[model samples]
Target: MDELVVRTEVYADPETVYEFLLDFRGYAHYSEYLREVRTVSGDGGPGTRYALTFAWWKLTYTAHSEVTGVEPPERIDWEITKDIDAGGCWRVTPSEEADGDADDGSRCEVSLEVEFDPGSASPDALDLPRLVSFDWVLKKAIPLIRGEAERVVERAVRDLEESTRDVDLEVYVDSDRI
Candidate 1:
């Protein structure tokens, strides 16, 4: 399995960031390929199911997922149920400045972490268009998927900062491979 982690520090508190991350629907706007995130069942909490549609060029796939875990004001976890074997988590925590003191809830670090094995999922179940093989699509998409993870977090940070305050905030994206 390959893991990707994207992080950024926000001028908002942990609760604020947590609430923003809790709403999975907003994620569709963060990535260009992500067309929609529709709720299938339950609320935003654990047990909620979602259909996340991603489209690029002539390819479109709707991946099913379920909210597997949630910790208020801190974290949310989900597992993909169809077309792929993947899981991800959103983490929000108070940021500690250089002086080793927490920012008194004024600033926090927000992170999105995902784990997936490109080869683990079977292509037989995929609904591919005529003359388009799943292997061909995977070869072309694997690289884009990695970059998409980074792009999503970068956009999410910018949107969150813009929504929190009127003034523009500096955006810094820290990406890690694990």
Candidate 2:
């Protein structure tokens, strides 16, 4: 088993970042490797499950995931249960500026650990000897995953900002009643 960790900081509030990450359906908009995503069971909170289909080596494979932990506007973790070898977490918190202002923006980090089985009875075959010789598979996949995660976060932040730009907050104020 091989493990890799990748982290990135996104410019957004914890709540906005957390909400975007929780919505698996939004992955297709940002994740370069993910071709399609479908929710198989439950909503996006803890215990939610989804089927993620991605292209690997010009072929597509589906994986099942269940949310293991969920703390609103803070952190979320998920476990891969079928057709894949990975678990991941998304963490969000205020920046260290001491202002406690999410509107000023914050940061978020995402990490994943994956293990590939060389002896599994699966369609994809692992070249054990080559892996031992050069460790190419691990080396290649980690960077790819890291890049995809970064792209996803970047697109989500941009989308969030654009969606909120046209809202008018003054409409909520009732001057006559006051």
Candidate 3:
């Protein structure tokens, strides 16, 4: 089993960040490698299932996943059910300095653990010899995951900003009409 942990500060509120993380279908809008996402069962609540595909190394791998835990505006955890044995979590913590007096920002952390069976497929499946010789794959994968998480955080912030802007414009228009 290989584990990767990434932590970063996002310039968005905790609630907003948490909500974005739980929006499984929106992952492709943020994750650079995720090519597609679809809800398979349930309603994105705990135990909801989803299918995700990632485009990397000129190959697309699909994984079935289920939400393992969810706590609004705080934490969410998920486990992969097919293709690979993996799990991940997203955590949001309030950032006093970035938020100023409004509590508008948070520090986000994402962690992932994945284990692949080198013997499951052909000898060339994962280039096992290369992995043993140079540790190339895991090294590359960790940084990729970190960058993806960062991008997701940025996307969440942008989404929140756009939503707020839209709401403010609506309020202004309504006030003028009244």
Q: Which candidate leads the pack in lDDT? A: 1
- Candidate 1: tens digits of C-alpha lDDT, residues 1-178: 7777767777777888888888899998889899999999988999999999889878778889999999989899999987678898988878897999766788887878888877777787567889998888877777676668777777777787776333322333332322
The lowest-lDDT stretch of 10 consecutive residues in candidate 2 is 169-178
Measured on C-alpha atoms, candidate 1 has an lDDT of 0.79
Model 1 lDDT-worst window of ten:
169-178
- Model 1 scores a TM of 0.87
How far off is residue 174 in model 1, in Å? 15
Against the true structure, what is each candidate's TM-score? 0.87, 0.65, 0.63
CA lDDT, candidate 3, residue 37: 96
* Model 2, span 58-160: residue lDDT tens: 3455777889889887778887786445576766665655575544565544333333342232334343443243245444454465456556655665686
* Candidate that beats the other on TM-score, 2 or 3, i.e. the better one: 2
| lDDT, each prediction | 0.79, 0.60, 0.60
Cα RMSD of all models vs. native, in order, equals: 3.9, 13.0, 12.5
* Clash count, one per candidate: 0, 0, 0
How does candidate 3 fare on TM-score?
Answer: 0.63
Q: Candidate 1 — which pairs collide?
A: none
1 against 2, candidate with superior lDDT: 1
